[model samples]
Target chain A: MDFAPLLGKANFWAYFFIMLTGLYGMAVKRNLVKKIIGLGIFQTAIMLFYVSIGSKEGATIPILTAADAAGRGGIDAAAYINPLPHVLMLTAIVVSVATLGVALALTLRLWRRYGTLEEDEILARLRGDPGGEACTPRS
Target chain B: MIQEINAAILLLLMVCAVAALQVRDLMGAAILFGAYSFLMCLQWVSLGAVDVGFTEATIGAGVSSALFFAAIFRTTRRTKD
Candidate 1:
């Protein structure tokens, strides 16, 4: 099969690999904090990928340059990179930050309640195992 | 030209990501994650998304790392397989 097009699309492929790395960390890591870190990496990778798609090879920044305003020639929109993706990414970044903050807060609460961050340990406590004396009720 | 810089940055990002995942020490993993975020921010800037890059720097590299540190302090820093 022809692989030239895939080879040329380096940015997309790179970001895809990054995203999968994050997913693997989230899925396989045993620590709650590491899972959150993985989720953050995944989010950033998606945002970067979106931003890359809005760029053009020869275009300048989206802002109106002085030359564009003073020139007699009509301004061509195609001369500037697309701004919509950037705007959307800004909003997404804000939301991602807020979500990360909330996730961290919850994690702190979980840590305080359980005295540990390991998922398996916490599960063992919840299941009323012999070693989880703190979780067992007094007779 | 610019593509070469981007390729190098991507390579760094991959390395940081692997380090973050493989580090046995939780604190070390957190620090590596911060580095990974900063590298991702640079990649965004190189791709011409200045605003996104700034946001990533502030949120991903700055506030997020601070919050992670705080959470780490509040909990045990040990991770057993």
Candidate 2:
């Protein structure tokens, strides 16, 4: 085996595990906060995967140099990392932050609406009377 | 050489994921998830994805974790399990 191809393979597996962990947390955890955290993890894993795909071995930054500035076609760009993915990731990071801010704001509103943050407790309060002693499934 | 480094980062990521899952405390889990993101940034760096690593470190490890904690602060930290 050449073993060279395996160099970046670990990134793929790390992404996969991170994704699975996030998914598992999202699915199993009942707390709204936990769910949000899980979603964050999931998003992070995806970003990692996207970024890892653009990486190349022994590649320089994809920028034009003064020495190659006079060239008609552009710089001698051999072994240069892809710039497109970097640009895309920057956009994605901005979007993710915006969305997260909105989500946090919504969570605050939810807390204000109900005295408790627990999903079951909120549901009980929303159902009319939370003081009922009857044994009922929260959700 | 690169393979070994990648593998080490991968192992670190896996451990962080497991710790995030197995912890009984929700806050602890959120922090572990942040650590996982940090390791993942390193993994991306090893893969030559500097841009991705930068985003992961900032948004993933930084903003996302803060947002998650904020959301959690709005909700109950205790879990039935």
Candidate 3:
């Protein structure tokens, strides 16, 4: 099999690395805030991959520079990159922002009640560890 | 070439991600995350997704960073691990 083509697929490799890095941060990090950052990174990597896939090697931006819709002539759609991914990604970006905001708010509440942002400490407190026996789960 | 540019940006992005993950300071990690978003936005624009890139610039780099800093303000900046 010819493996040379894979070297040219920089976008694919970049996205793969970013996704794995994010996954590592989420799965291995002990801090709650770091996990949120990882989640954002993971989401951004997916969006980047989708956008890259929608691009064509010889295409221009999706917008038509001239008024071809004015009926003087028809616009050649092939000249422009596909617009569907861009539109879908707009909605995705908004959703990510909303989710980030909510997650941060929850993090704030957790910090306020527990006085720490470390996942292990929170779990310890929840389990009524000896040193954290004074801590009780808040309803 | 387009591939070279993408490779450079991707390298920088990975560096930022690693730094953000390893930093002991939460605020520093948030700032690095913002830089990561900007690099990703540039990659999107270079790949011909201007609309998606613009959205990422505003939401990922701008609003998200602001929210992270605000959240950091409410908590201690130092991480235990």
- Candidate 3, residue B80: Cα displacement in angstroms equals 2.9
For candidate 1, give the DockQ.
Answer: 0.67
What are the lDDT scores of the predictions, listed in order? 0.80, 0.72, 0.86
Model 3, span B9-78: residue lDDT tens: 9889989988888899999999999999999889889888888888889989999999999999989898
Model 2 collision count:
0
Q: Model 3 clash pairs?
A: none
lDDT of 3 by residue, A69-110 (tens): 666434679788998988988898999999999989998999
The TM-scores of chain A alone, one per candidate, are 0.82, 0.78, 0.83
The alpha-carbon lDDT assigned to residue A98 of candidate 3 equals: 96
**iRMSD, model 1, in Å:** 1.6
The local distance difference test score of model 3 is 0.86
How much does each candidate deviate at the interface, measured as C-alpha RMSD after superposition? 1.6, 2.7, 1.2
Better of 2 and 3 by DockQ: 3
Write candidate 2's Cα lDDT for B1-81 as tens digits.
767877877888778877776677778877988898788778767666677678779888997788778767666566643
Q: Candidate 3: misplaced stretches above 4 Å?
A: A1-7, A67-74, A130-139
Write down the DockQ of candidate 2. Answer: 0.51
- The window of 10 residues in a row where model 2 chain B has the poorest summed lDDT is B72-81
